[model samples]
Target chain A: MEILTQIFSLETLSSTLRMATPLAIAAIGGLYSERSGIINIALEGLMLAGAFIAVVVSYFTGIPWLGLLGALVFGGLFAMIHAVVSIKYHADQVVSGVAINMLAAGGTVFMLNIIFNTSGTSESVNALPYWGPFKPTVYIGLLVVFIAHYVLFKTPFGLRVRSVGEHPHAADSVGIDVEKIRYICVGISGILAGLAGAHLSLGVLDSFREGMTAGRGFIALAAMIFGKWTPFGALGASLLFGFSQAVQIRLQGLGIPTEFVQMIPYIFTIIALAGVIGKSTPPTAIGEPFEKGKR
Target chain B: MGVDKIDIKELAIELLIPLLAIIFSFIIGAIIVYTFGYDPIETYAALLQGAFGNLNRFADTLLAATPLIFTGLAVAFAFRCGLFNIGGEGQLLVGGLAAAWVGTFDGLSVVVHVPLAVLAAAIAGAIWIAIPAVLKAFLGVHEVITTIMMNYIAYAMVAYLSLKVLANPGEIKTPPIEASAYLWRFSNILDIRSYMNLGFILALLVLLFIYYLLWKTTIGYEIRAVGINPDAAEYGGISAPKNIILAMLISGALAGLGGAERTLGLYHYYIQGFSPGYGFTGIAVALLGRNHPFGILLAGILFGALSNGRTFMNMAAGVPIDLVNIIQAIIIFFVAADLIFRQFIPNKSEGGVA
Candidate 1:
């Protein structure tokens, strides 16, 4: 009972929320892109770019919101590389994403040396002010979730995005531009991933570190998958993973093995994907390039 | 049979595309280098010298290429069957752990112990992938998600086992295997002062085996048939589900063998994070090689040289090692979307951006 209370404390819940914020933000962004029929595996790269850019900008300007703006521009521009190659050039979606990740991991560190004259990490920078128990970005992330749910399900734009994902040819027959919708959704994904990255560097912890996202973007992908590509589903799934991460952190002082503790969320992910939850189908037209006048 | 006519034009184009991608990437790299106030020529020259200047350096390059050859073949084999295998890292861990665990056993003959350990490693890797394969073939679940998740799980599991069950008293790593379980080193026969080992030969034999299996056999035909059109292959009485599992098993085995080579031939123990993303690099190698066995071999050697020479480039030119990374990524991006450049080249034979 004592252990359960300690595990279920308000502080732990808050930390869980804090951890889930970035994941939820990133996953919701992915939900848009994936639901719009383009795979957004470059979220990891975008988030890393956001984190790096946020730090550098905030370090210079001393204002967190301005840093957030930098993340959006840089992240959006970085994601356009994937967008152009995948949507415009008809490159393999998976390969484009993998390339983005490799680029982000390497490019961020390379920039670290060029700009900061340091490798592996950046110096301490001015951090975002927290409001009460949470950072402002945390609240913004949750707000975005609600807004995304509305935009994805309640609006005509949402219906078009859904229709585009379900059947691009059918959508095209109805006069919707599939490529334009994909480009916009992917761009939005970059923006949200940027926000998520900024929260990591400015909100959760001060300064920047190489590969600071640390598979959170991948975890966000898993959350997106686990949530069945729905915004609310993404929220619930993120919390579940967030809870496991919370537990892992809590278990550090115990005699239990750290590796086993860390395995909780990943093992849970595999089980959920395999069949603990019902089968989650992807968008029908997802991962296929939009070609005009083709069958 | 008459000697096949060497179409030098076709050959030139085949080689020229990748060469152009490399040169383009280097140009971009040079811009980045110049921005950082470093000379690109000096950096590249240092890289070449470090990778191939001496016999010892060449041996190091081969030693580095050994594991890449295994993982590259792993990815290429699966690609031939139209499967996306992002789980090589996980498969490698299971195989390495199995090999390490088996190698702990003493009082065995060299032949018996070594083969036993390697076989265990292969089987372990196959079993690890069997889960994703079953899920993919039967449940229609994409292997990408399952395999990526499994990679994290495998990392955690290995870390746990290595610390709790397999660790030597003071070390963070597993106990070293018996000398009998060690692979025969090439340096022994060559009398070279390098770490080159029999793993290189093993990688070559596996490469040949994959080539034969994918081309000469009925199974290969069926796998390729399914890859081209699953519905048609099914209509022709091929079991798509079975081939999926079979291909994943073979791919997993190859990746696992890579792990075993690193453990038994190089480290002689299972160390944490032993791979250094060889499994991920396999994807780039396989794609750049166009999924052919010989192509994968050449791509693997090229990447091996890049990795082996990055340190010299860093030390001599005062450039960061991440330049290799940027170049690698640019290469993949260009290869994946070569139509970006193919448009400029007047190739009447090619279609626009398919």
Candidate 2:
């Protein structure tokens, strides 16, 4: 009974919230871009860019919030490269995203080599203040989910974005600037992803390690898909994956085959994508480039 | 128009696009080098020298390329059939594990043990790929997400097996396979001190086999038909589902063969992190090669040269070898951005037609 109580304690729940925050934020980011008819597979790369920028800024400025701002700016700028490639250059969305990811992976380490005089990791910097084991961004991130839900469902801009995503021809006929909407949404998503990266660097860990986000950005993508691209659903899925992350650490302490435990969220994501958990449908124009005057 | 004229036109475009992409990549790399306060011309010269300095260096380049050829072909073959197999890394992992596991038990003769180990790897790779293929075909799940998920799972499973189940305690890798399971090195036969092995020959054979299969076989025709237009192929009585599954299996097998090369040819054991993003690099190789068997061979060799030379560039130029990866990334980005490609080239279709 004591073991069970300890296992289900608030501390474990708090850790789960911490783990989920990045995923939730990134998923919401993906939600906006996908809803605007662009595939944003560069989320991973954007997150990495953000993480690297956050750490570097925080280390230099001695201010964590400035790090977050720097991360957002860099992350948005990095994502713009993907946007130009996918939207203007008419690149295969997946390939462009993969390139962005590779750039982030390599470029960040390269920058680390220059900035910190090392390759694998950055210097340890001051982390963000905590509100009883939770960073301020944790609350901010969770709050953004609700804000995202409201804006996506309630606002006119949300309707315009959805219209562009679903039937671009119709949206164009209706005088909607599809490309403009897509650029904005993609930019916003990039900022969100950067914030998620900032959360990882400034909130969870003080230093940024190479590939430290590991597969979190990809996992956040899975969560977005698992939730059927809905902000609330994405939040729910992210929390679930986060809970699994918390449990995996606990299982490690119990001497279980913790490697398998580490795999649970990914496995669950596969199952979710397989429609065992629920059916998921992506935006109709998600991977299609919006060419003007073309049906 | 004469067939020869059309063929020449196609060839010109094909060669031009990749060349332009490479030039663009290096230009970007050069700009970045200058920004970082390095001499771009000197760096590129050093890169060239490092890659093809001598026979031994050339052999090292090919040795690095051997696995890439297998993995690149895996990605290219699948792409020919409209399937995106980002799961080559996972297939390679399982296949390597299978080869290592099979190698653990060996009193067999040379022919039997080597064949058995390679076959184990191929089958293991096939089995792993089957999961995603089935999920995609039957359940309407996208292969991209499933394959990516499988990669993490594969990594985790391999980590577990190597650490807990098959560990040679205190060593970071499993026990070295017996002599019978080894892939022979050309260097050994010639008494040269080099890692160059029979795996390059194997990569060459696989390339030829794939080229033949894609161009000559009825199955290959069906696969191409489905890839070009799945609905039309279905209307014309080709089973799109079946071809997708078959392509994935073949892709998986090719990747598995790569794993076999890594275990039997290179390490003689399944070391942790044996694959240094070779699977992902295969995607760029396939694209840069224009998904042609011969093109993949060329791209694979070029990448191998880049990989081998990166360390030399780091030591000689005071630049992080990560710059090579950045160059590779830029190349892939250009490949993806067809509009930019079209803008520069002016009158060419996508790579397939070119």
Candidate 3:
């Protein structure tokens, strides 16, 4: 009974919110990229870059906000490379995404070795300023989710983005610049993903570790799919994932084996995904490359 | 009369792009090395020596290539059926775990136990992939997301089973397999220091099997037809959904065999971190091979050489192993953007035949 009580405590709830914040931020980012019809599988790499850059800049400048800003800038720059290769050069999206992931992993480790004289980890710095006991950052992230939801369903640009994803040919025939929309959406996705990484480094751990993004990008992707790709739907999905993670952490404290607890979120995700198995559909042009001459 | 000349020109044009792409990437790699204050010639020389300097090194290269052949075939097989099986990592991990479980159990002869373990792995891998295939075929779910999601599930499940359920109690790994289940190393008889064994032969056999399966079978014809145009294939009396599932199952089975070979022939036990992204590297190998069995064999060896050389390069030249990864990234970039290279090399008039 005590163990059960501990599992359902207030501390667990707060931690759940904390864990869910980054995932929600990234899921919204995935939402934008998918809505615009560009499969942004590079989200993980972009987030990793953002986390590293955020730590480096913050360590040097002693300004967490500046670090966040640096992450946004660098994340966008990294994402631009993906855009150029995928959108402009017509590279396969999966291959380009894998390249980005490998590049990020190797590049970060290389830079760490050169700059810090260590393997793939950065030294701890002064802790970043917190948003207060209420944790203003969480609220802000939620607000962004709401804003994104409103924009996606309410605005004309949003409508154009969805049209582009569903049928690029039809969208182009209606005078929409499919490439331009993709560029903007993918670029913005990078910024949001960067923020998520920044939150992990500055808000959660106050340091950078190699491979720290740790498949959070993929988890966010799952959340987006499980949520049916809508912003609010994604939020619900992320919260559910967050709760599972929180339970895992709590179970770890209760003397139940940590490994078994760790399996909960992943197992639950697979089962949840199974629920939407044949019913859920992605955008029509999700993985297809857009070519002007092709019918 | 002029058609033959046009065909030759077109072939030359098509070949030129990939060649230039390779050269350009090598030049770029050289520039990066130079910027780091390393001599490109010496580094490359060392890389070559490390990869092929001795029999032991050559064996290491083959060992590395062994599993890649399986995973590469897995990816290529799915590509023929128009499905991108990104869940190779998950399938490989699951298959490896299954092999490890069966290999450790006692009371079976080597001949029967070894084959049984391998079969268990293949079946497990097939089941692992079947979920995504069913979703795609029946539920209209995009396999890209489903497969990627499955990877996370597989990773977690493997970790859990390794630590709690299947753990050897004292250690985080399972107990070693019985001697009968082990794939004997050729080095034992040859008195060499290399780890090369029957696994390489098995990989070659699998490659031959894949080639025959893809090129000589009616089912292969159905898969290709569905891949090229599912609607048309259905119109032509092929069952698109059935082929999709079959392709995934076949791909998973190949990946499973790769895992089995690793466990039985190489490690003889399952350990964490056994796969250093072999599944992902297989994607590049398959793409670079152009989905041909012989092409996959050569490409897998090339990648294996690079990976094996990186260890030697790290020891001899103080070059980081990460450099090899950078090379891989460059290769994938070039391969994925092959059209970019094609544009620079002017196409011949006869190339319009396609």
lDDT of 1 by residue, A175-216 (tens): 999999999889889999999999999999888999999889
* Worst lDDT 10-window in candidate 3 chain B: B1-10
CA lDDT, candidate 2, residue A172: 91
Q: Is candidate 2 or candidate 3 better by DockQ?
A: 2
Give fnat for candidate 1: 0.77
- Of the pair 2 and 3, which is ahead by lDDT? 2
- C-alpha lDDT score of every prediction, in listed order: 0.86, 0.87, 0.81
Query: Across residues A1-295, which tens digit of lDDT does each residue of candidate 2 receive?
Result: 7766766899888888999999999999999999988887788889998999999999999998899999999888888888888887777777888898899999999999888989887999878898866898899899989999988889999899999889988999989998889888889889999999999999999999999888899889988988889999999989888887887766777787878977776788787777776778788888888777754
Task: Sum up the clashes in candidate 1.
Answer: 0
lDDT order, best first, reads 2, 1, 3
- Identify the candidate with maximal lDDT: 2
Per-prediction backbone clash count: 0, 1, 1
The CAPRI classification for model 2 reads as high
Highest-scoring model, TM-score: 2
Q: What is the TM-score of each candidate against the true structure?
A: 0.95, 0.96, 0.93
